[model samples]
Target: MRNPSSTGAGRLLRATGHSWRGLVDTWRSEAAFRQELLLGAPLLVLVFALDLAPLSRALLLATLGFVLVVELLNTAIEAVVDRVGADWHALSGKAKDAGSAAVTVSLLVHVAVWICVL
Candidate 1:
């Protein structure tokens, strides 16, 4: 899948395309991703609309971004685990559980940060 021919703008374009495809696919397949996005959308507006300090705004933005990033990572982990097989494997369960726990921890941190800032 490595495109040696891609250089400069072509490379950027291809990378962007790959990212776009991932986002679209994640949106379609992951309910948590979609829900987090939808919930964050309004909070995004609130962050900009409020008269908060610069640092507070940044913290708010950072947490929201972090949540999405963690969610995406979790989804990727789940997909890889599922691809390996549907059989009952303890290691697979551990991997998936760990990924879910990561997402939960991220959301908890995000909530804590927002509570402090807002």
Candidate 2:
């Protein structure tokens, strides 16, 4: 028979893989991901057109990545809120609003970096 410890480890690996795939699916379905990709693609092109130094180009890309990352977290929060219930609840509203605020701040930061760098 297979070792019990190895079997348990395999189950854990599968569970982790499944959870990651679910997150990826959510990212694909979310409109926020589409918006970010649209904006980021053009921003990346502009950065390239500017012919920035290697460090500056990297910083610009990193800032855009931060915006996308925050968007994914916001999507996750909204998904959880909806998953919990459709009915209005103060705490649920606050959680989602807070997540949106994070996205806003990330975008603002990206803008600030672009202004300073370019």
Candidate 3:
């Protein structure tokens, strides 16, 4: 018998809900997230429109997903930093800068993948 909080399906459902909430919040609050979505959405459709190998298509899609994941993580970092305090701190600045760098790296990877595949 699965414990109330330990069942695999139950945990998955809860996680899904949490993820949906995060996505909605990010979409509403983050202009960068919205812009990335706008850029990625059309490119994703174009990926489908082009004649590409299965592996190439999968890699292309995965790179786009990586960008979104990185952006979400960056947003989370910024939110936590802001929650901690409004005062300027070196550590806080480092955290936010690191998060931004991660997003930039992800975008670069996405571009590189697309260039290689096409």
Q: Model 1: runs farther than 4 Å from truth?
A: 1-4
Supply every candidate's count of residue pairs whose N, Cα or C atoms clash at under 3 angstroms. Answer: 0, 0, 0
Which candidate, 2 or 3, would have the higher TM-score against the true structure?
3
Output the worst ten-in-a-row residue range by lDDT, candidate 3: 1-10
Score each candidate by Cα lDDT.
0.93, 0.88, 0.96
Best prediction by lDDT:
3
Which is the better candidate, 2 or 3, if ranked by lDDT? 3
Q: Write down the RMSD of candidate 3 (Cα, Å).
A: 1.7
Candidate 2: where are CA atoms >4 Å away? 1-24
Worst 10 residues of 2 by lDDT: 2-11
Give me the displacement of residue 97 in model 2, in angstroms. Answer: 0.3
- Arranged by TM-score with the best first, the candidates are 3, 1, 2
Tens-digit lDDT track for model 1 on 1-118?
7767578888998899999998999999999999999999999999999999999999999999999999999999999999999998999999999999999999999899988886
lDDT of 2: 0.88
lDDT, candidate 3, 65-113, per-residue tens: 9999999999999999999999999999999999999999999999999
Candidate number with the higher lDDT (1 or 2):
1
Against the true structure, what is each candidate's TM-score?
A: 0.93, 0.77, 0.94
